[model samples]
Target: MSGVDLPGAIRLVRANNVRALDPAPAMFEGMLRGWEQQQRSRLLARKTINDRLSLVRRFAEFTGTYPWDWTPEDVEAYFATRLSRGEVVWSTVRGQQGDLEMFCAFIADRRYGWAKACLEEFGRAPVQVCHDWNTAQHVAEFEGRPGRRAFTYEELQTFFDAADDRVEQIRKKGRKGVLAAWRDSVLVKQFYAYGTRRRETSMLDLSDLRHNPRAPHYGRLGALQIRYGKASRGSPPKRRTVLTVPEVDWIVPVIQEWVEEVRCGFSPGRHPALWVSERCGRLGVRRLDEVFAAIREHADLPAELDLHCLRHTYITHLVEFGYPERFVQEQVGHAYASTTALYTWVSDEYRNRLIEDALQRRLERGGGGTLMPQ
Candidate 1:
């Protein structure tokens, strides 16, 4: 790497005579600010920067020592405490350690001059404390909760029935929130119909619905232009368009009814949001979770199944529906096919059908020979 200028306009460097009543704490805060600036210049998102900073602060508090005195032992102790409490999974531990590693790299870099400043004042300098030996290994692609899974076919139908039934139940009482109840019903339908993540579903605008030339019967509801797809680290939200599949095409009329009739009842004058809350123009991601939770409870579904399982349900159904895996990957906006595979948990019935089909094909090839054991 080319030599970087000393101090480099970061907030860490100061005059020799500059001092604070509490110099250690002051310098620690300055180092954090300088690290924040470095990450900002890389165009990382605000939440990403804040999360990394928060992790470093927690580590420091746990160790009761400034960055300059941190050691590999402190890293082990801190994470061991978290492990004892089951505070994080393996993937989360790895990410937190990576954050500490990056922070150490920032302060220790000669270009920033933080080490020089710390050495002159405290006679100590920060060194990278998180090493391969002490950090969590990234051996598994999926480390999510084992109980979490896609909804079963019966469970899927029951949940939808519950959401739909709630609307009429509200109307029967002649309640004021009937319009809102209707909105939630339509929202639930779109969730399974499209398989969007919560934030992506919440961020949808009326303009995101588009006309498909080949699927003209469905009109503007034929495709969904997902503008806020999930992104990888240090990147902006991704974008993809999900075409409506024939199996879930029944949602076409449900969405159309919401837009053309029930949505106008919300009296949202000029808001472009497709899912308009009764109190707000656009529904929020948190509200999406709350709505799903209420419906799942009402239906008495398994506690382990969550809003994201609607997405899992979509992926599994598509795989069973025999769409090409590439097509399924594109519809769900997964960058890799392996990621799409991780979301799928096909039902035993689907697996049995595959076995039956294979046996039938073999029997036909062998002219009905029944004694073949290869």
Candidate 2:
């Protein structure tokens, strides 16, 4: 079959056909193209597919051979090179191995015809070099650094106060950055208030706001529609509605002030983004990190406690505020209760309250008396 008609590894009409040049590199290029089509067929995100293709190319370049000629030694050599150089963190090794494994699996599959094609061209079929013994095991759950942690309530308050103070100080001095400072302050609150990731917060738009029927008091700020929640492999961005709990209900006025007053000053015009920039466009994720870092430094917070820690803090605070595990999961767009549970590192005060409440319940059940003998 012609490459145009065929999908995945079997296509030959392109450079893969090798009418003039040496067949090896041409065939390798074809293999990548086929794998790309195969991944696209599964509806994987473009960036995800691109990253995988790049991984396979890097592996091929390192080995100085195409997939058909790869061996287990090549895989070991590749892993060893990266590990020795300290180029990536330990968790990153597992991800790189997974990408390579997926690519080998794609080419080795008989249905894709890569194996048969390679055999006819080079007298050998492509084989999966990544195996159980060679690959890193995923034993750890949380791979984040030890220093990246949820802010204590006091620390969080200080950070918020610092951001708010920046806005006020700018306004008092009549500085040009007053609007930017005010926007940053509101943006930081939005991060903690909604428990949103940087990209999700960056993607927020004015139209994403809606009133929750159960909480009319919060009005249009009762819930936020997260259109770009992190996607699963081969899936589009997940969408969820995070309702404003009473713990973060203060955000109602904050959101109102931004939308009703501040955001418009950016001259957003037809732009619908909730966070507009000086250029009258939606804010980017990098800008969010820069803004958070600036405020965090001013507040003297831990340098390791980055923007994502705000998410951890939000989840922890929500759990402390007596929201059920499942409710917190939904609010944070976690697919599993366990995932949400991982984000929760309840404060000592909350844990102590739990102990007291448990003992009270036990007393109520046991004739309202202490069990200890006098």
How well does candidate 1 match the true structure in TM-score terms? 0.94
Candidate 2 residue 6 C-alpha distance from true site, Å: 5.6
Task: Show where candidate 2 strays beyond 4 Å.
Answer: 1-6, 12-18, 172-174, 360-374
Candidate 1 — number of clashing residue pairs? 0
246-341: candidate 2 lDDT, tens digit per residue: 877889998899899988889989998999899998899999999999999989887988999999999999889898888889999998997887
Models 1 onward score TM values of: 0.94, 0.91
**For model 1, the run of ten residues with the poorest summed lDDT:** 1-10
Q: Model 1, residue 223: what's the lDDT?
A: 99
- Residue 334's lDDT within candidate 1 is 95
Q: Can you write out model 1's per-residue Cα lDDT over 21-103, one digit (the tens) per residue? A: 98999889889888887888787889899999999999999999999999999999999999899999777888899989989
User: Could you tell me how far off, in angstroms, the CA of residue 92 lies in candidate 2 after the best superposition?
Assistant: 2.3
Tell me, by lDDT, which candidate is best. 1
Error of model 2, residue 332, in angstroms: 1.0
